[model samples]
Target: MPGIVPRGRRGPEVAGTGEDDSVWAEGQVRTITDLARLAGVSAGTVSRALAGNTLVNARTRERIQQLARSHGFQLNQMASNLRRQKTGVVGVAIPLGHDRRQQISDGFFMTLLGHLADELTQRGYDLMLRRVLPERDEDWLSRFSGSGMVDGLIVIGQSDQFERIEAAAAEYLPMVVWGNHQEGQRHCVVGTDNRLGGRLAAERLIAAGATRLAFFGDAEPMEFAARFAGACDVAARAGVSILACPTSLSVEPMTREIAHHLHSNAGGFDGIFAATDTIAVACLKALRDAGRAVPGHVRLVGFDDLPIASQTSPPLTTIRQDIAAGARALVDLLMRRLGGENTESLVMPPRLIARGTA
Candidate 1:
């Protein structure tokens, strides 16, 4: 599933879970019907947004049209490079990052792009950023196959969308995935040891003498799940009882969603392993608010080691994915493809960043 959509009326919500409420599936196919109804604007607004024209006054219309245009523009930029006898255009398809709203703000993806773009620029290739929402995977196939806007592609998606992306890679284009890609003849992947990260989080907590642990937040993410599973495996070896609770971004970060879990399960748990830095820090906040003490009430460990990790009162001990290393690895593969060399997948190790939380 596309993670657990929270409960709400307008935003991405699951409403009330039952046999019917969940709409997410691993490797699921998406269609325009799942896209927003906001695309129903007049063609004029679409044109303005696409062209970045000031004539479009509606912000929502602008966002929609600009999104489409940015995608098309990048594609054409790729084609334009081919005509010049040297197409510096390197196409990159990043996951939507959020729901239908097209949140292109995934920090790891952004950081990777920053490093990837710098590396590509040094080699005379221009980065063509494309927002590949779930519904547009098929469109990317056709566009990349014939658009000439890009000579190569690097796809960044989570496990939830990886397999669907794999199908397109198998059929067309010179493409590599940024993270754990399902095994296939044509697909290459570069990522860190996610399971190791989970293990590190668990070990950190265990060393601090936490016996009851739970990995929360994106605990359900494939990568995070690996972390949780690894932690669970170790916790089991240590006779530690661990629970994994997943929370969605659509819900308030550290509010009732966490309080509900903590309040209900706080009895024996003394350690928390969060899947994301965002959720981990928030959990820390909630833990304090609920009168639970860190390292005393509970020890916390988070993944990603985002900047805020160090700012939290007790600091955070977490696993750090070498995003820079992953980005460099991706660029190496892309360069190999550009050089007509054999494409190979690369996997890096996730480093553990130790601080006071655990």
Candidate 2:
């Protein structure tokens, strides 16, 4: 008898003959149901047989496998994942609350994202990225978590949405964040100790003979704020003055802002501690434009010893946050959370990388 056509395939169903082992035509067994009917077994049996569930009798499993191969039957991964209640995907969100203009192409973010992609791919999960604006959507975290598109979430930055993330963490278990760790926060986080990093940067500047320090970058974001606080901790103890020079993370405005700060405070500060290496690089350029020598007339330091840090004309001395290790920790914590484990926050120590600038 003619074989049955699979549902959703564009074909007419052929009447089945009374034979017990009739050959299913190509394209006829496109789905489990189609394959099961041809093999004279239930859909569950076909699924178990396809999955090599040893519970299915050996002869029946072999018969089903041969039929599936002969008819070119392929399992629907989406359907299988749905049955298992998983999407096999992880969401990577970058919330731009403090700097709405910040792009994912920013050096620091790009570097971290590349590491995250590598870590996620190695663990058999696909990455779905989204750039969110918390100002526009107060429920951004809830929406992303409830969208059911991803199995877990890895928020790249806290931005200015710490409260929102905390609220979401109360409900969502399989979420991890990369940002500063507070004394008490609800969400699971894996990140560098920004406060310590800031302290290290400031101390390095002070040891380099900088009496007055200027912090370049916005201090609103929690991570940056902690870094600023750390720097303040060191500055206050050493009796050296530190000033926050708010700079944007976006490239165009960042350059312009750094130039203005340098032009306006050329003789005011002897040391500069940029919030990030990207900002430090921009500050380096601004200093060059203003003809202020790095570590000669003014000491400069940065955070996140990214690749470009060493490649700069006068290599940047910065605090190093292990991005790759952070990525691994984020994934590991998220997987643990997925497994119903209550993982604690992981704050990795930041090491000071001494290069030419400082």
Candidate 3:
């Protein structure tokens, strides 16, 4: 079915439906370039006319359109877009496993992604996800940014490896970051005020009568540290001590480290503030196994009210961030970018979720 056409009425009406799968599923394109060249014009010009480019000459454009109409070329979008100089795709760069999981999924990235996708689709653009690694160089970002692959990009997640991110942003690849801190001000950021969320968590813990507190974190992701800073400021103001947890791969490894600290300081600790629910859940399990009674011995507070947070033994008291809000914010930013508008960075507030752990 190389150049097959369905049994139908003869002419222009046939152009739109020639590629219908029922009739053309096994049809071959061979090369649209070959067809464009046969019409005595540049391939780009031939495409411009086929895609309704107003910049193309009138009579010549109509002839090109008529020629394409004759061959059923207008039936395939991929063929027409090649002439229009539009990729019809957006590249979304999200940091892989680089930040607090709760915010990434439950708070910020997930919602922003859904909204961005919806908005782009409404405006006739397709989403193209590109995972940015901590060790990627400028070369990777450049090739990824080239016009044919995607027309624009959205960068999400706060990375500990800011240098790599910075290098990529320096390319000016029509990209924006999910956060506004130094990285966003220096480049482009679309995120919420995580520091305020941290302060709010600290305020809740202090109100709970838990004075001796410890904080746990998986990595020094910017937003994670901001949460830690907010807690530290609150602890300082309350005249309480706060311990930041050392970095480790998972709950088990971190538990071993926290257990050593607990052993070293017998009655010096009472409450633990975990930056993520995953780490918090791990710490809670480890503390319980070590014969430390939760609430009765060590009250706990975790960030991101994850699904499993409530199912835990005594449950987890935590903070709730607006994931949908963040998503909307991101999509709004992207829409603005699409419309040639320059927008400032945004940081939404965080809410506290109380349960059994605290």
Candidate 4:
């Protein structure tokens, strides 16, 4: 069996030779079987060589591996996973409609997803997206975790389902969260210092001589709530009365609501701090419709320096979170947990990107 190899079904070449005429004619090696034929070795020997087993002769193993690498022959992951009883997959869950209006395309979630995908792929883990719709289902995490679809889970947003997440964490599920630091979170979390972001936004508005300020965005999500709380705390100290305007899920309705709030208030607020860049954009449109000049009539600030923030008519000043770093921290924490090491939560600092608005 030194030189004898199987011939491709397409045709037959001279026997007892390492070179398969069909493979040479095709000018490509498609599989380990093809490499085996080319190197005059069996598929098992190729596998052993790729696995770095010392059983195979060093010279033969090195030659086979070099050929495999040159030919770009990848191992059959399905077969490998079957043998190992593991999927090498990581589940990423984002509450798509948890707020009944939020979508996956929301700037923050979209950015987080891109970073997570990149980090996971680089670390040799396949990302499996799981968009949880709390409106339709309650026990989404349990189902995702128990199905054995992934070695660990990374949840993007801790919507109104924090309790459920806590329960899953209590059960010792290997998972990481990307959101605010809650009082009793059992799972590892990687998030921005949202409270400081909000405070910075408010402080900027105040420094610009804004006395009457309004807080835009919902207060249900813990992240937004913390930002709102920070603003309120600073507002209280500065003797500025802060108004609250909850935004709708869609831009149209949210714009209308913001317009109505501004029009009815009638010179009540001199500045506004939006919880997110998306909400900030809606507020800008509403202000324009209401004939209010940005920073001239009412200064504005927003969280998350999304792409659209800088392209707005006058540009938007926003709190910038280290999305890439946060993504890395989440994946790193998850990997540590998977490696049987206890990891701690991480909270990244937020910085204000001052632009035309504030």
For lDDT, the strongest prediction is 2
Global Cα lDDT for candidate 2 = 0.89
**Could you arrange the candidates by lDDT from highest to lowest?**
2, 4, 1, 3
TM-score, predicted candidate 2 vs. hidden true structure: 0.89
Candidate 3: C-alpha RMSD after superposition = 7.6
Clash count in backbone of candidate 1: 6
- Write down the worst ten-residue block by lDDT for model 2: 18-27
Question: Which structure is stronger by TM-score: 3 or 4?
Answer: 4
Q: Look at candidate 4 and tell me the lDDT of residue 45.
A: 96
- Model 3, range 1-358, lDDT digits (tens) per residue? 7575663323333444432422333343223454465566787787677768988999888997787767665445564467566677878876654433343444335555777787778778888886655454444456677657676777776566466656766655366777537643455675656677677777777777778878778537777878888888899999999876664534355668767766777677687878877677887887888899887888788876756778898888888766566656666676676567766767666788888876
- Which candidate do you rate higher for lDDT, 1 or 4? 4
How badly does each model clash, as a count of residue pairs? 6, 0, 8, 0
Superior by TM-score: candidate 2 or candidate 3: 2
For 1-358, candidate 4 gives per-residue lDDT tens digits of: 7675443344555563445445444656766777887788898898899888999999998998899888888787777877786789999998754455555867888898999999999999999998878768877888888776788999988888787888888776479999999766687789988898889999999998899999988888889999999999899999999999887656677777787788788888999999899989888888887788888999999898988999998899999988989999999999999888878889889999999898
User: In candidate 1, what are the lDDT values of residues 3-112, reduced to their tens digit?
Assistant: 76533233365563533323453212121212222356665555455556777667865677555544332233333356465566788876663333322454555677
lDDT of each: 0.69, 0.89, 0.68, 0.85
Stretches of candidate 2 off by over 4 Å are: 1-29, 37-41, 57-73
Model 3 whole-model lDDT (C-alpha atoms): 0.68
Indicate which candidate wins on TM-score.
Answer: 2
